[model samples]
Target chain A: MRALVLLRAFSRAKAHTLLFSSHCARRHCHAPAKRERAKGPRILGPDLPDIWRSPPLDSTHPPPPLIDANQEINPTIIDGNSIAEEIRSRTAEEVHQMKDAVKKIPGLAVILVGQRRDSQTYVRYKIKACHEVGIRSLTAELPEDCTEDEVVDSVSRFNEDPSVHGILVQLPLPQHMNEERILGAISLEKDVDGFHPLNVGNLAMRGREPLFIPCAARACIELLTRTGIELMGKHVAVIGRSKVVGLPTTLLLQRHHATVSSVHAFTKNPQDITRQADIVISAAGVANLVRGSWLKRGAVVIDVGTNPVEDPSSEHGYHLTGDVCFKEAVKVASAITPVPGGVGPVTIAMLLSNTLDSAKQIYGLNC
Target chain B: MRALVLLRAFSRAKAHTLLFSSHCARRHCHAPAKRERAKGPRILGPDLPDIWRSPPLDSTHPPPPLIDANQEINPTIIDGNSIAEEIRSRTAEEVHQMKDAVKKIPGLAVILVGQRRDSQTYVRYKIKACHEVGIRSLTAELPEDCTEDEVVDSVSRFNEDPSVHGILVQLPLPQHMNEERILGAISLEKDVDGFHPLNVGNLAMRGREPLFIPCAARACIELLTRTGIELMGKHVAVIGRSKVVGLPTTLLLQRHHATVSSVHAFTKNPQDITRQADIVISAAGVANLVRGSWLKRGAVVIDVGTNPVEDPSSEHGYHLTGDVCFKEAVKVASAITPVPGGVGPVTIAMLLSNTLDSAKQIYGLNC
Candidate 1:
């Protein structure tokens, strides 16, 4: 990735934030708000009015769905936690059957470069998921000051081990290290994160499918398809253009024949674009970015944002929140995913699924 | 390409049409009219009005631009032939300077797998361009009955040739051959066509640039940028989704921060969507598919289609036409690209530029 090249040019302080800030702060909170909100430059014409913006919803339209965040009878609240449990149960059964036939179970290796609290929590969740699915979990925890070569060496060890069917490098390696070099070092066959360029290329292309889709991206699409929501010809606006979630998810939606619009940090009037969408998937990781007014009537919303906001009243010092203003969006959306229990659960489930697939592929076993 | 894999599974007749029909018929002309006209499957909530369609140009709206299909006084006609000639001249000067410095010039090797007349014409044009630019052009002409292994072997020879800085394998190879295998065999370093997955991956990524972009796709963007057309925040509707042109172009546009909507064969009511776009680039190779009614009054239209339609008045039985109906669209669009003289000429020039770039990269010379 070009990020590797830029890292070498970045100042020590800049590189530190670039590499570790995502894990340390939990949100892309580095840039100045004014600078970030400048909006992308206009290229099509001399400043045109935003044609996508819809006027305020009037009573003539169907009344806004009831706004009751605590109510259970409004729109169908997608139960991602339950669906993930179902997936884990099925994966466990498959592991059991595979162990009986091949005398081996799937194994996952996660290489954590630093002791960032957030990264640690994610790594722990993945290991727990593997355990629940009856698969072996191995972790290589390196120090904060570890060399890039050292990180690669740890990955190489797992790549060489026949028992390790899947390898995941915990992201946001130390500022001093080259993230692309270490990630690229992972053998493609064992790359469960699907961050490898080859896998991404295959995903972007037609007539070619990625061997492994990024877990979070796959989970978002899985939620829609599993819910029997047809994707063909739908106008799905994706709010976020990050490599991990937004970009790949757009490609996946396109593969399903959905007309996708990617609204990123530079997008002008993102709400206007989201309102026209038949389905909205936001992964900007900005708390309460999407509000009730941004939704079209009966729009399906999938919130991939997991921003931690300060909450002194809660047991923890902070509480996780989604990009959408869930309290308000729930009243307007036909279906919506809740933070903490939404895409997170399904993402872990997908990691387990990918691991099982890798093991099956290695053994030439049919599912 | 997935088309290559599907070729293996297709009946011989289907495979023949799939691979050779583009060359034989000069466009995607085999499908039934009804099937081609049928709207894409519905995915967004039930049948809805064509929301994207704009009303006819009236007094309320600005009057249509001058009706000037035969005249050249309204929108600036992008003179591809002149621009390509300028590119060739500059490339020649670069080759001269490099030869003076290092006593060597760039060499390009082209592998022709079959005797398709259309394919031959394209190959000849490339060779002529190379000659004009003072680059050595090597041709390896294989028969129609050549095996897939033979094609790969030909590419391998070019890959090993230290003198060759660029390698191009003309598309629409013989029906019996595996297109992907042969294309993939070309060394990534000398992939002038830029179809390699690595190059595509780089193109799709943010903060990353491809070693080489597909020439035609590059030409399209080059025209926009060279003409001082701003791309940022523009709603660019791309009317094709082919790997060679549409898909890569969309990725390139996104890199420029454009809000892009990809309209493809599966897109329903494409006219509605096109009318809403500030800029439209169509590459479906469907003659006269875009009409005046489909365009915004001041939109910029780039037609990449070069479909050969029956023309009794011409010396040849057919003449080239574009996806946009020039007569109707020219009156509506602020700027428009003509069929044969637009993207086609720029494509040949881009190949020269790519070859020159390859030489610079290989020789460690700065431009």
Candidate 2:
């Protein structure tokens, strides 16, 4: 058991590609000969083995039961996308069942600073989702030049306002504003992003859940479990160690009884280690990073990356792809979440779920 | 990896014990019969394996470098008795450090609801420890019939008082009063006991530290580290999964990178796992549960149990013996902490440290 960990001690995350049979990829593209292999710092270059070498082409062990690019059998696809649809319909029904007809609505205040396009899209979608769910969403788009006091003032207003059940500041606030301070200012009850270290810490510990669930982290688990994937007694491999993904995912999985090994950018020979997993979740942004060759047969893959790759055929000048190299993986894997459908929709579903939770908490109502 | 994790699914809090011949218990006690061996539950039992059952018990697979418990050495014979006196002198110097002369002495408001004799003793020691640390210690003892609101009122008063930087309400409040209500009311910033779910959650997370440290938890780490015991890359087996001890202790050690395992009452074979550890920290209230036969050669054992065992020979009529069978474990363990002196003094020391940290946070000085 210890021998495998030691063997990978000097290995690093590699860009894996599958030598797809002629039936796949359709052309003699001969996927870019795996390049940019990570290697330890050495005075002399190209010292020994290639750093960017593609993962082994040899199929060694019996393949894991997984959902790769080829295996498009995500449970949600067959269930009529019913889980999310139920949530949306429930939100509609509940909103219609309000107390006053013009009752103290679920109030969510979002603070956005600067013009980061991604943050803007997230905020926009959140507000739209809130409105769709009959939540009164308030947007506070402050200028990049705004001071820390300005952000704190906005948070203070939401904290006192009985109308507001949640306060979420769009992340990546201007450099001048202390993210911790701005988040902390949002009273614990109203801090809906749950990015407050206290919230994050609370989420990690036993005996309690977060006041406002971090949607992305929760979504990763939801996608995995809803597909008849039980967490207990499973060997799961998670890539990425960001506070948002890798670390939180590990804590959540442990809570559910999965013996997990974490691999990040600093991990050695991550592919070989990952190949041993019953489930693989990649949140790292490296594009087409996970190829069929890297996966254990039938291993479930949930790609959280939303990287955009250049594709002239798309009107946007580029196309969004997942961390997985889909075509080759589909032939060997069992189940896989598509880039745009699997986790993305679940993220929104959880956000709505958390907002509903926030409303229930504030109103002393049971859900 | 999958099979071991499943067939040997174990908690990571306190794991890895007795893997060598040194684990043999002393002549002072009888070993548990082969038929009565301690085994963790088949599923999530205590994380430690009975290391004594493993092979190559010597230099080939040594005890963790940080611990190096000389199972053959008697701590009393090795000057461990002087640790208390040495601690006393060091604590005295800290009080006289002169940095707090002009400071508004940080105060801890300790509230006791019921008159349990043991509770009284614990509180008294804590108050005295605070005094020795040059901090103001306020005592508020309420009647057993006190209402929940009354308890909350005292906590509110302490929270409002600028002088109080820490608050601890003695445990086992009367059954009539809601413990959660009283605990939740103590300001999170001054919760020194760290029983509040918020505090517990914070400490459970990786890359997160509680604002006000948990005393016993911190003490375990401090005591081990002060004695030159490092946890990095070692495996620690923790017995007990109580909120106060087993669970938090596991989280604390994991943060230190000691592959930890947790064991609770439901564990099928507890000692079988403990035998594999480089270190064993047992907080289970069970008496003499861990014995020499279950230990690996030279394993360090930190017995956190303060269980009062009947002993007519002692002045108190009841004497404290650790969860471990001390007499037998003493012969096998490289270093073993005594029941009364080992953990007790350090727990007080850490409480003082937390009070000091609370003061720094409150005053924003010398942090």
Task: For candidate 1, give the lDDT of residue A17.
Answer: 27
Can you write out model 1's per-residue Cα lDDT over A1-367, one digit (the tens) per residue? 3233223322322332224321211111111001000012210112111111221222223223333445453577888998788778888988999999999999999999878989999999999889888999999999998787888899888878889989999876666665555776777667778776666766786544455778888888777876777777777889877678988888878877787877776555566567667889998878887887787778899999998899999887899999888998887888899998998999999899888877876665662
Q: Give the TM-score comparing model 1 with the true structure, all chains together.
A: 0.79
lDDT of 2: 0.60
Against the correct fold, how does model 2 do in TM-score? 0.64
- Predicted model with the maximum DockQ: 1
User: Which candidate wins on lDDT?
Assistant: 1
lDDT of 1 at B33: 10
In candidate 2 the C-alpha lDDT for residue B48 amounts to: 30
Off by over 4 Å in 1: A1-74, B1-74
State the lDDT at B171 in candidate 2. Answer: 79
